[model samples]
Target: MKLKLRVIFFLIFCLPGLAILGYSAKLAAAAHGLTSTGLTANGTIVDHERQTRRRVGQWYCPIVEFFHQGASYRFTDNDDCKQSRHDAPTGSRVEVVFDPAQPSRARVDSFRGLYGTSLLSAAIGLPWLLLGIALVVRVR
Candidate 1:
């Protein structure tokens, strides 16, 4: 294959894949940083805000409450489950991970809550990356 064509194809396929992979890695690193280095406390699943999306149908945003330094902080989790998931029902106990400087900005210390964004991004990026590699190798 022509060098220009190869370079163009590599840019088209590899660039976005690498960008996404880098972003996913950054997200995962942040999540891990908060989990391993931030403060931790026991929290409760207070409620869930019902939400609807076009084509994605229904979902629920979990509301959680926790205490840190004699202060109670409540916030909706950033876990994006695009379905009626009752995995963590109201009154359930969960681990809350938070930064000491900003307790209000906390998250549930579950697998999905901690790494969902990264996992989702990797799901999109890894395959695209592999396809790009395969295409570039076979583009003779």
Candidate 2:
């Protein structure tokens, strides 16, 4: 009975926590790589895409545009799209950091835009991981 409970609990909590932690680590690493090895350019907020969810309500995601190697590239900001529509009005300037080899894949050069997903995921995952570890240790 004790071993069965431990297995069940580990399967339910620990595995998912580990998965989330790994995914967040990957995201953080990508951001770090881009910042370290990418090219910097001035970008403009050309548009906003309206995104809605029941839990998150509605928010506008900034669509950014920049020129690289004489060609223009546009990419949606991948940051957590929880900001108000007014947060980034069109025509506003933003610093863009992109892989020079793949300019289309770019990110807004801001702390939140670059690292928000990783931070949020880590914050959510760490507790579940700790709880799962506690459960396993206590069960044993």
Candidate 3:
């Protein structure tokens, strides 16, 4: 196949899959960071299988509500807290960082947590993407 065709095919198939993975990761990470308190009322626990360990893993995620720039926003861990550590007890108050311009943008701890989640999704998606590319190359 021509390079243009390969690129087009890759974008048509791989991009959607990767985009879904990436956006979901971003949302999960955003929600995970929003929770300022430990797992409890607004928080949730997700049981998901780990890609690396191939084992069922549990993650404690929190729901945080905060006010920034004269507006209030809320979010939850959803699925991004897979490997995050629980540092405080339930109801323990914690500082949450959020974008003042965008109150919905928040994090329970470090920004790295979200980045890690996104990276994890990319890592998981890369092999299939590469496999498709390989098949295209081989057929070509």
> How accurate locally, in lDDT, is each candidate?
0.85, 0.90, 0.54
The lDDT leader among the candidates is 2
lDDT of 1 by residue, 12-103 (tens): 88888999999999999999989887988999888887888788877888889999878889998867453655766789898989999999
Show where candidate 1 strays beyond 4 Å: 80-82
Badly placed stretches (over 4 Å) of model 2 are 80-83
Compare candidates 1 and 3 on lDDT and give the better one. 1
The residue pairs found clashing in candidate 3 are 31-76, 33-107, 33-108, 35-64
| Candidate 2 lDDT tens digits, 1-140 | 88998998899889999999999999999999999999999999999888876787888889999999899999998583646867788899999999998999899999999999999999998888889989988996
User: Could you tell which candidate, 1 or 2, scores higher by TM-score?
Assistant: 2
Worst 10 residues of 2 by lDDT: 78-87
Writing each residue's lDDT as its tens digit, candidate 3 over 1-140 gives 47777787677657766775777577665556554423222222222222343375655455656655555566664434445445433454545555555556555554554466666666767665676666567656
Top candidate, metric TM-score: 2
What C-alpha lDDT, on a 0 to 100 scale, does residue 98 get in candidate 3?
A: 57
Evaluated at residue 27, the lDDT of candidate 2 is 95
